[model samples]
Target chain A: MSNRSHATQERILAAAETLILGRGFSSTGIDEIVDAAAITKSGFFYHYADKNEMARALVKRYLEKDNQVFTDLFARADSLSEDPLQQLLIFLHLFAETMTRMEMTHPGCLVVTFTYERYQADEQVADMVRQGVLTWRQLIAQRLATIAEIYPPRLEVDLEELADMFTTVVEGGILLTRVFDHNKHLGRQVLLYRNFLRMIFSPDPSR
Target chain B: MSNRSHATQERILAAAETLILGRGFSSTGIDEIVDAAAITKSGFFYHYADKNEMARALVKRYLEKDNQVFTDLFARADSLSEDPLQQLLIFLHLFAETMTRMEMTHPGCLVVTFTYERYQADEQVADMVRQGVLTWRQLIAQRLATIAEIYPPRLEVDLEELADMFTTVVEGGILLTRVFDHNKHLGRQVLLYRNFLRMIFSPDPSR
Candidate 1:
């Protein structure tokens, strides 16, 4: 695709995601998305074969965006510290800070939005969302396993569960902050997770 | 209300919630709910004045049911142990075990369901969901405050944030388990929270 077309596709996807996040997939009409994107119907059809294709593209776009963020944060954390445990902790702090930096309650996650309306998507769309979550799990679990090898945790923490706890905290944090309209709760949850990690790994174990 | 009418009402509500959770509020039609409930259109109307009223009623019903379960579990935990920290831990275990007891992936919480589709709901519906989450936060914080008085958390945990962590864990756990079709993750996440609590408290430092 041309750069202009690519940019338009991104704009359309962003509008779709924002609408779907607030309402749902099935209820978010194509015309509404086109209007929001300031694109013509022909422009939308040129980019997506159908609603299913659009949904798939949205999931793909979201996952790639999320993966980029994760990779960037982890890379920055890795450069800052040698210890795998500290690196993971630093990564979470960075991630949480990003949440705190959001001007509004974080837009709810795309994979989570898809998960709730799985019945509306085709098998391909479902697979994209499932893979999106798996990707997150693997990324966190890899760091956690590295930490497990280095620190020998103060608790019998399952690496997978530990990794998932981060995902849960973010997802749950989004829900809490959105529901209560309190943006700080997301940061607090992240810090709470950080506090838990500190208590588990810090040699002195003093706050 | 007559027992028969009450039972039919439950049937309609159950069908509506199940459908709504799978798809979403706007996508789920009244006819689909009636068909699922195995009731006629008149029967559904008899139970609920309209779809809006049904949505309101469902939120009210779900919050009450949830409040009842949380209260019962905490009361049971309090009775089981003298230590406030221990009581809270026990409550999570029971809660996790309860998640395991479900034969299927959780249906998801009604408050959370409404949250994703808040734009579609009336102000009253939105208020109920907001209130529902607040109630959960208050309930969990009350217990954590009790624990704080006794334990003086070593990590300087915010009682409200710590309590919100439980909400996040469960909400996150439900999302993970449901997305993966694995019932165990929910219990495992709960246990992870339990483990975090243990690390935060307990006079013994043993892993």
Candidate 2:
């Protein structure tokens, strides 16, 4: 009985994620999610008191899965690529690959969509999104610092600032992609970023 | 009669702009805008067909004003300081001053808020925003090229790429400022940008 109940809850969550990503947070209703999941209203309310509660559960679950993928990608540093700059490049490629797969096969970033939709409506959810963003930025910053350490005299750039820039570019790129329905622009952005990376890693005469 | 009619329309536009900047596009409703402007529903529709139409008018007005400012900023080339790098610094300072004033005096960019809100919701408005962004990037690229003419060959980074980066940073900074309700982060971003300008304008070491 418990196994069947758990399965039903998972189905509902999966359906909610898809619906929210496609139609956005505010527009997607509880009725749509339950219908997609093949569940009754009573079953849905039994699991979640309201749509907000369901969204809270969805965000947490989505973040857990997303973080796992990020952790795995950043792991195995010693196994391949001795050069930190090359490792960073590999990470970028992997990041793009992961995003392409998820967006094409599943849906978009729930946190980004939710943040845009619900940030002003609900303070508690907004705080969660803000903290999540900070945590993600810190992760990128730490990796950038590690990569910067591989260079002679380290780097002239502030790793934290660079990380923020990187995060912004990726997020901004995703936004542009959604607006235009193309990944070609993001490819150009990546190339521009590569040049920026080269500018930093190369020997500086001004230094 | 026309003067009174014009004044009423202007008042409605101004009130909507202020409200949208402070609270975001989605959260601000027609009722609130009417309330804020002290206008009737009939009067509101007299000026704008709908909220979207009002936003379009606001965007057009903003772009006109922005174009005038840009022209003035770049007009005095010969009379100003001879140093290209110094000129760039002064430009950044002037731009920062205007941005700070906007935030302090009124809400931040109306176009920016509109872009984030309506980018996904409406296509025509999104195109307007995309063009607005592109035009700003192109203008900055022209400025960077002007600076590059005063420097050595290798010191000249891709002007378009650099301009795009500048736009990205400013947009990201403003978004962060809105989220955190602070300008310190924006200050840090501008400082970093100034440093980048210095790095680019400096002589090439490999030469």
Candidate 3:
């Protein structure tokens, strides 16, 4: 695609994302997205064969961007600390700070929005969402296994379940902050998860 | 007013909920709801003045049922254990079991579905959602405080934020389980949470 066409497609996806956040994929029509993007009908169809195609493209873009953020943050944390547990702690703390600095209360995630509705319009959208979550689960679970090898928790904890907790806290924290209309608790929840980790790993409880 | 009207009303709400689970409120029309209920338009109007009224009724019914479940489970836990912390652990264990026993991956929650889309359709719907989350937050926080009084954490933990974690894990766990097309993790997430509580409260790290 040419630079102009790429930009138009970007604009169209952006518009759809914004509307989908406020409503849902089914309620949001292609015409509204085209109008919002200042593109003609033919221009919209040129990029996406249909809304289902758009859903696929949007999830792909969102996951790529999300994975990049996680990779960068984890890599930076790893550089700062030799201990896997400490690295996770630092990563979560930094992650919370990033969310706290957001201008809005984390304008809902596309993966979450689509998953909650479980939209029948696109099976591919749901597949991508499941894939995105599993990717996060895998990412967090790998670090947790490293931590468990070095310092096993007093309680028998499942490494995979522990990993899913990170995803849970984030998605759940986003809901709480959004519903309560505060950007505050997403980071707080991350810290709480961090605290749980520290309690499990740190040698001393009172410390 | 009559039994027949009450049954019809329930049928309509149930239909609306079923549809909304698969989509959003805006995408679910009253006509469709009445059609699903096999009720005439006049019968639908008699029960609900408008879609706004239906939204209100749906939320009211949903919250009452949700709260009752919490109350009953907590009561059972309290009866089973004298210790507050033990009671919470038991309640969470039972809750997880309840979720695990679900025939299918837990259906999508209304509050979560609506909150994700950040629906612009009704302010009242949003308010009810916010209220429902707060109710759960308050419910969990009260139990956590009881646990804290007897067993404070090693780290400085915020009770309110900790309470929200229950809500977060649950809502998040449901999403994970649903997205993965498995009804497995919701309960496991609860157990992981229980382990976190155990780690925090027990004096010995190696215990």
Per-residue alpha-carbon lDDT of candidate 2 for residues A78-169, written as tens digits (9 for 90 to 100): 34587777666666666666776665577456665655566677676677667776777788777667766666422366777776666556
Lowest-scoring 10 consecutive residues by lDDT in candidate 3 chain A? A99-108
Best by DockQ: 3
What DockQ does every candidate get?
Answer: 0.64, 0.31, 0.69
Candidate 2 off by > 4 Å: A1-23, A29-46, A76-78, A82-86, A100-108, A147-156, A179-181, A187-191, A201-207, B75-89, B104-109, B145-159, B204-207
Worst 10 residues of 1 chain A by lDDT: A102-111
In model 1, the number of clashes is 0
Measured by TM-score, how close is model 1 to the native structure?
0.93
The RMSD of every model to the true structure, in order and in angstroms, is 2.2, 4.0, 2.3
Of 1 and 2, which scores higher on DockQ?
A: 1
Residue by residue across B64-104, what tens digits does model 3's lDDT show?
88789888988999999898888888898988887677516
lDDT tens readout by residue for model 3, A55-159: 898889889988998899998999999988889999999998887775173367778778776556578888888888889888888888888889887466677
Q: What's the CA error at residue B86 for candidate 2, in Å?
A: 5.1
